[model samples]
Target: MSAAFEIFLQGTPGLEEALAEEARATGFAKAEAVPGGATLQGQWTTVWRANLKLRGAGAVLARIGGFPASHLSQLDKRSRAFPWGDVLRPGVPVKVEMSTSAKSKIYHAGAAQERIERALSESFGATIDPEATVVLKTRIQRDYVQFSVDTSGESLHKRGHKPAVGKAPMRETLAALFLRQAGFTGEEPVLDPMCGSGTFLIEAGEMAAGLWPGRDRRFAFEDLATFKPDLYARIRSEAPQPRPLEELPGLFGSDRNAGAIEMAGRNAEAAGLGGAVTLAHRAVSDLERPAGPPGLVIVNPPYGARIGDRKQLFSLYGRLGAVLKERFGGWRAAIVTSDGGLARATGLPILPPGPPVAHGGLTVKLYQTAALR
Candidate 1:
C-alpha cells in the first residue's frame, strides 16, 4: 500500500459543513471541516476515489511535501533538491501557482512562483506551460512552505455530462451540497419549478440511481506518475450498477421558457437519465403537486442582481408560495436566492437561512421550511 498523505477537499465557502458531512458519509478517514474545505488522511487510491466520488468538493488537492523557507534563495535551493520525480513525470507540462501571507518572509507570491518554476524546468527537465493540465499549488504562510497538487484538472462542477447550461445555472457541486442541506436522501420525489437546464433535478435523479458524479469525467491525477491504471479501473468497477429509472423516486422539473426545457432534456439524456426525469415548459404559477407522497420542492430562482427587477420578483415569489401552501401540503421547500427579502416574499414558514454561499460574484443563502401543514 502507498503511504498516506493529507488530502484537502476544496468546498463551497459557506457550505463547508455540508461538504464535511458528505465526506464522512462517504467513509473518508479523519474527515474534518475547516474554514475553506475539509481534510483527510489517505493514500493514492484514496485520492483517486475522492476525485471520483466526492460531489461537493470543488477540487481535490494532495499535500505531497514541502519545507520551511524564510527567503527566496532557500526556497530555490530546497525546491531543486526536492524529489519532484516521485509524483511528477519528467517532460510533462506543468503549471506553478503560489499564495503568500505577511507572516511569511517570502511574501512575494509572483517571485516565489518564478523560483519554483525555474527549479522545475532547469533541475527536473519539466516543461512549464501556462495551460498545462497539471497544477502545483504552493502556499507560504507563517514562514512555512506547503506544497499541494491540484489533482482535479477542471472544477468538479463540470461533471463532464452537462455541456448545456442556462443563464446563471447552479453549479453541480453546490447543488449537491444544497440537496444534502435540504435533507434529501434520494428516497423521495424532488420538484424544481424554476429548473433552468434541470441541474437540481438531474443531480437528484443521479443520486437516486446510485450513480457516481465523476464516472463520466477524466481527472488530472491520471497524468501523474503515481496513477495505476489497473487499480483505478478496479475502483471504477466497484461502483454499484445504476438502478433502473422506474425503481427510483420521481424527479420533475419545469421552466417557463421552452428553450430551457429543451436544453434540460438534452442534458438529462446525456447524463443517462432520459426516462428518469420529467421536464415541462410551464410557468411556476401553473405548477401542481404530483400524484404521489409529499417530498421536496427546491428551486433556484432569478435574483435581481443577475436577472430581474426586485419588485417584480416579489409577486412571482408570492404566487409560488401561495401555490405550494394551497396545494402541496405536507411537503418541504428549499429556495436558493441572494435576497432575503425575495425569500421572505415567499411567505413559507422558513427557518433561518444557511450560511452565505458565494455564487457567480454574489452571496446567496439557502432558505428552507419544515413540512407544510
Candidate 2:
C-alpha cells in the first residue's frame, strides 16, 4: 500500500479524455485515458486525494494486486495467498464481484466470485456480505486475474448534496464532464435553461468557488486497512478554501416547471451554492441573456425517447434555437439529446457531436456550437 500502484479513475464511457484532462490539471501528472477510465500511478494518499477532488470519476479504484490464474484451483490458491490483510480489515464486511472474458479459462464469473469470497472468509477472516459498502472487483481476462478495490463506496455522482432529483435528471458526474466538454472553466456565467435539480449550475458554482466535490461526503477508502486518519485529515485540510461566491461569475438556471425550480433551489442551497445560483421558474422562450459577458448555455432538454412526444419536441427545440439565436449572441451552447433530429432542430450551427454517452438507458451525444454570432 505504501508503494505506487495503478489508480483507475472510472469515468463516463465517452468522457474518459475529459476525465484525464481534469486529472492532469489537478496535478496527477501521469494520468492517461484508457477505454473505460483514466489510469495513473499513485499510493494510498493519491487514492484518497482522487476520491476527494476528482469531479468526473464515477469511482476511484486502487489496483492492489493480481496474479495469473488459468484454472479454478489456481484462482482459489492465488486468492488465498493474496495479502488481503494489507487492504481489507478483519471482521469488516466486504463484497467480491467478478467479471470474466471468453478468452479466460475461468469463464464462470459466479464460480470465480465464490472462490474469492470463500478465500476472503476462510483465509483472511473477512466477512463476505452482498450488501457491503466496500467492494473487491475481480476481472479475469485472457488468463490474467486482476484485483481492484472500489474506494469510492457509492458512485461519485451521488455527491450526497442533491436529494431532490427530477425525472431523468443528469448525473452530477455527467454534468461536470459536460461543463468541461463545453469549454467551461468556471470563469464566466453558466445558464442551464432547462436545468433539472440545478446540477449544472450548482456544479459550476462549486467549481468556480474551488469547493471539492467530495468534501461533504465519505469514501469507501476510509474503511480500508491502509487508510490513515491523520494523513487524510491533512489532505482535507490542505484543500484550497472556497472562494467567496460573490467574487465568482454568475450561475443561473430556469425551468418551466415550478416544482423543478424549487427542487433546483433546494439542491443548490445544499451544495453551498444557494446564494450564488439564480433559479427561476420560466420556460426556455423566457430565457434571457444575463447582464454580463457571454458564457456557456448548456441544456439537457427532454427528448422524445423517454419523456415527451417526438413531434412536439421539435417545436420546443426550434423555439429554443430561435431564442438563443436572438438573445444569446456570442454565447456557446451544448445540447444533449438522444435524437439527432431534435438537436438539428436547434439549427445552432453545431460542430460534430462528441462520442455517444450512455444516460438513463439512452445513448446521448453532446452537440456543441461555436460562440454564437
Candidate 3:
C-alpha cells in the first residue's frame, strides 16, 4: 500500500486552498488543493493525521487501485487485469459507487458494476456481495475512471463526542469554515451569544489547543487488508501535544433556553474544553463584551425559511439587532441566514453577503457586520 492519498473536502466559497493549508499545518507535505479536494503525499500515518487534524475536510479517500478504460470492453478488460488479491480477500463483501464525466460509451452504472463483480468473482472466486466490508467508489470524470476507497466511514462531523444537540445546530465543518472566514485563530475570546449546542465554541477551543477533530473516530478504510496499523500509530505518536489549557482564552456562550446552555456545557466537557467555555442561562441582550480587545460574535439565529414563519423571524432578527447594538459595541459579528429580509431587519449595515452556502439543504448567505464602538 502506498503512503500517499487524496482527500475530499465539502464546503462553499471554494476553500480548497484553505483545506490544503490546514493539512500542511499538521505536517502533511506537498499538499495541493484541487477543484473539489486536496492531494497530499505522505505515509499511511499521514492518512490518519489527515482525518484527525484537518477540520475543513469531509472524507479521506485512499487511491487503492485503478486502470483507465475509454470504452466498456476496455473497462472490463482492464478492471479484470488488476490484481485484487493485494486489497480484497475472498470473504469480504464490497460496495461500489460510480461517477462519470467522459466521452466514452460506458454510461450505464449497472453495466459497470456487473463487469467489476464478474472480474472479481471469476478471477478469485471471491463472493462479491452487493453489501459488504468494502466500499468502492468509481469516478469517470473527464472520460477517465478513477476508483478509490473511502477511509472515513461516517461523516467526519460526528467527532464522536456530541451525543446531544440543540435546535438548528450548525455542522462542525460549517462552523470551522466560518471561523476561517472570519479570521479566527483561537488567540482571542469567542462569544456565541445565541449559542445552541456550542458547535462554534467547541471548534474554537479545538483550534486553540490543537486538538485533532478525528481523534475519537474510526475510519472504514482501517478495516481493509492493505491498511497498516503500525504506520497509523507512528503518525499519531508524532503529533504535537495538546496546547496548554491556560493559554486558551475564556470562551463564553449564552442562550435564553437554560437547556441549551446545559447541552453546550456538556458538549464542551466532552470536547475537553469544559474549563475554557463558560455557558450561561442568559439572553443575548444581557451579554457584555469581554474585557479584552474586540472579539467575535457569531449567530445563526432562526431565519424565515428555517423556522417556517417570516413574521416571527423578522421580530427575532430585530430583537437580536437591538441587543447587539445596545450591548456589544466594538465586537465583530457574523450573522448567517437564508433570508435577505431578516438580515435587513438587523439594522446593522450589512456588507454584501459572501458566498452562498448549503446549510440544512437551504442556500444561505453570510452577512457580516461590525460594531461602531
Compared with the true structure, model 3 gives a TM-score of 0.89
TM-score each candidate. Answer: 0.99, 0.98, 0.89
Worst-scoring 10-residue span by lDDT in model 3: 4-13
Compose the digit string of candidate 3's lDDT tens values, residues 1-373: 4545554543333556666777676667677878766786654556666777778787777676576676788888877787777766556667777666646567777788778777767776667655564677887654567777777767778898897798888889778877877778888778888898999999999998988888887877677666788877776776578888888976888999999988998999998988888887887667766777777888888887777789877777887788778777887778888898899898887778867777887878778876545
Please name the candidate that would achieve the greatest TM-score relative to the true structure: 1
* C-alpha lDDT of all candidate models, in order: 0.93, 0.92, 0.76
Per-residue alpha-carbon lDDT of candidate 1 for residues 92-155, written as tens digits (9 for 90 to 100): 8999988999999999999999999999998999999989999999999898889999999999
Clashes of 3: 3
Best by lDDT: 1
**Cα distance off (Å), candidate 2, residue 174:** 0.6
Which pairs of residues collide in model 1? none
Write one digit per residue (lDDT tens) for candidate 2, span 1-373: 5799999999888899999999999889899999888999999999999988989999999998899999999999999999999998777899988899999989999999999999989999898999999999999999999999999999999988887998888899998999998899889899999998898999889899999999999999989999899989989999997999789898989999999999998998899889999888889888888998999999999999878799999999999999999999999999999999999998889899999988888899999999999
Give the lDDT of residue 133 in candidate 3: 46
> With candidate 3 superimposed using the best TM-score fit, by how many Å does residue 310's alpha carbon deviate from the native?
2.1
**Local error of candidate 1 at residue 8 (angstroms):** 0.3
* True-vs-predicted CA distance for residue 282, candidate 3, Å: 2.7
